[model samples]
Target: MIELRNVSKRFADLVVLDGVDFSVRKGETVALLGPSGVGKSVLLKHINGLIHPDKGEVWVDGQNLTRLKRKELARLRSRIGYVFQYGALFDSMTVEDNIKLGITDEASAADETYSRKRALQCLELVNLDPVVAEKYPAELSGGMKKRVGIARAIAGQPTYLLWDEPTSGLDPVNADIIDSLVEKLDDELGVTSVVVTHDVRGAFRVADRIAMLMDGRIRAMGSPAELRASTDAAVQEFLERDLTIPVHH
Candidate 1:
C-alpha cells in the first residue's frame, strides 16, 4: 500500500499541497482529479520520488521514498512504471525497443530470452500485432504509441503504475478503450494505479475513487457517487453541466 501523512509541498511562496494525508491500498485504482494548476500532477511525482515534499513522508509498501538515496531511488523507480502524458516513447527506437526498455539493466542476464517473451506478451495484451514490434514510434498511430508505452511500463511487471493523462486527446471511443485497458491492467495484473487527469470534468467517467484537489489541498475525495452528492461549491462547480454554454463565452 501507498501512504502519505501530513504531506506539504511548496515552491518558494507557492504551496502545491498542504498537510495532505491519504493511502492507496494494493490493487486499487485512484483517480487524481482537479482543475488546472491544482498540483494533481505534482502529487503523482511525489509518489515516485520525482518530487519530494518539504514536510512529511511518502511510503510505498513500507519503503520510505523521501529518505532514499539517489541510487536507491532509481532502483525503486524501476519497480514502478510511469506513463507520461504523451506516451514519451523514444522516437529513434522501434516498438520492440520501447517495450524492452524496462528490461534494460537485466537484458544482458541469463533471463534475456524470458524477458523478450514477456515484453511481446504485454504487446499482445494491448491487442497490438507482434509485428508492430519492429516498427518505429512514428510509424504507429497515437493509440498504438500509447499501447506501446503501456507495454513498456509493464515490461518488468511493475507493482505500481502511474498514468498521467492516459486519455487527454483521444476520442470518446479511444478514451473508453484506454480506461478499460487501465482497469484490465489493475485487475488482471494486480498492479496499483494512480491516474492524474482533467478529462473527468467533462465525461464523469473517472476511476473507482476520485480525489479533487484545490487550493493546495484535497478539497473533496470519495467514490464518484459520493462526489456527485457533494454540495461543496468547488466540487459542484467542476462537475457542473453547461452543454448550452458557448466556448467563446
Candidate 2:
C-alpha cells in the first residue's frame, strides 16, 4: 500500500501539490488523472522517494519513505518499478542491455546467463518478440520503445509500478494498445499500479478507481461510473472536455 498524508510541494514560488492526500491499496490499479503539467508526475515520484514533500509523510508498505535512510530507501525502491513518460531508453544501449539494467539484485545481475534470460523474459511479458531485444532504440517505432521501457521497469518483478503518461505521444490506435497492455500487465503480474495520464478513456478502461488532480489538489476520486455522475462542476467540465475525443471501442 502507498499513502501520502497532506503532502505539499513547490518550485521556487510556484506551488504544485498543496495539501494533497492520496493512497493506493495493495493489488489495485489506480489512475491519477490531470491535465499536463499539473504535478501528477511529481506526486508519482514521491511514492519512490524521488521527490520529497515539504510537510507530509509518504508511506509505502508500512514504511515511511521520508524517514528511511539512503540504503534503506534503495532497498525499498528495488521493489518498485517506474516507467518514465519519454521511454527513457538509452539511445546508445541495445534493448536487452536496457532491460538488464532493471535487474536490481547484485547477485542475479552479476550472473551473465541470468541477466540474459531475464531480459528475454521481460520482453516477452511486454508482448514484444525476443528478436527485438537485439535491436537498438533507434531501430524501433514509438510504440515499441514504450514497450521496451515497460519491459525494463518490470525486469525486477516489482510489487509496485508507477507509470507516467505511458501513452502520451502515441496515436489513438497505439494508445488503445498500450491501455490494453496496462490491463493485461496488472492482471498477469498482480502488481499494484499508479498510472498518471490525461487520457480519460484509457483511465476509465484500465483503472479500478480514478483520482483527478486540479488546482494542486485532488478535486474528485471514485469509480468510473461515480466520476461520470459526480456533482462537482470541475470534474464535469474536465471530463466533458476530454471525453469529446472519440474513444475507439
Candidate 3:
C-alpha cells in the first residue's frame, strides 16, 4: 500500500501540497485528477521520494520514505516503476537499450540474455512489435514512444506503477488505446497503480477510483460513479469543463 498522511510541500512561498492525505491500496488503480499546475505531479513524486514533504509522512509497502537512507530509498524505488509525462526517452538510445535501463537488479541486468528476454517481454506487454526494439525514439510515433516509456518502466517487474499523464499528447483514439493498455496491464500484472492525469474521461475509463486534487489538497475522492455524482461544486465544475460542453452565447 501507498499512504500519505497529512503530507505538505512548498517551493519557496508557493504551497504545492497542503495537509494532503491519500492512499492507494494494493492491486488497485487510482487516478489523481487535477488541472495543470495544481500539484498532481508533485504528489506522485512524493511516493518515490523524488521530492520530500515538508511535513507528514509518506509510506509505501509499510516503509516510511522520509526516513529511508539513500541506498534504502534507491532499493525501494526499484520496486515502484514511474512513467513520466513526456516518455523521457534518451534520444541517442535504441528502444531496447532504453527499456533495459529500468532494470535495477544488478545481476539480472548484467546478464545480457536475461535482459534481452525481459526487454522483449515488456515490449510485448505494451503492445509494441519486437522489431521496434532497434529503432530510436525519433523514429517512433508519439503513441509508440509512450508505449516504449511504459515498457521501460515495467522492465524491472515492479510491484507498483506510477503514471504521469500517460495520454497527455495523444489524439482521442490514441488516448483510448493507452487507457486500455493501462487497464490491461493492471489486470494482467495486478500491480498497484497511481495515475496522475487531468483527462477526466480517460481517468474514468482506466481507474478503479479517482481522487481530485485542487488548491493544494484532495478536493474529493471515490469511485468513478461516485465522483460523477459528487455534489461538490469544484468537482462538478472540473468534470463539466473537461467534458468540453458546447458553449452557446
The TM-score values for the models, in the order shown, are 0.89, 0.96, 0.96
The TM-score, computed over Cα atoms with residue i paired to residue i, of candidate 1 is 0.89
Give the clashing pairs for model 1: none
Global lDDT scores for all candidate models: 0.81, 0.93, 0.94
After TM-score superposition, what is the CA distance of residue 46 in candidate 1 from its true location, in Å?
Answer: 0.8
The positional error of residue 66 in candidate 2, measured at the CA in angstroms, is 0.7
Model 1 C-alpha lDDT per residue in residues 18-80, reported as the tens digit of each score: 988877888878888887788888888999998999999999878999999999888888879
Among the numbered candidates, top lDDT falls to 3
**Candidate 1 lDDT trough over 10 residues, lowest sum:** 240-249
lDDT of 2 by residue, 87-169 (tens): 99999999999999999998999999999999999998888999999999999999999999999999998999999999999
Task: Please give the RMSD of candidate 1 to the true structure.
Answer: 4.2
lDDT of 1 at 199: 70
Query: Residue 229 error for model 2, in Å?
Result: 1.0
Of 2 and 3, the candidate ahead on lDDT is: 3
Model 2 error, position 246 (Å): 9.2
- Candidate with more favorable, higher TM-score: 1 or 3: 3
For all candidates, the clash counts are 0, 0, 0
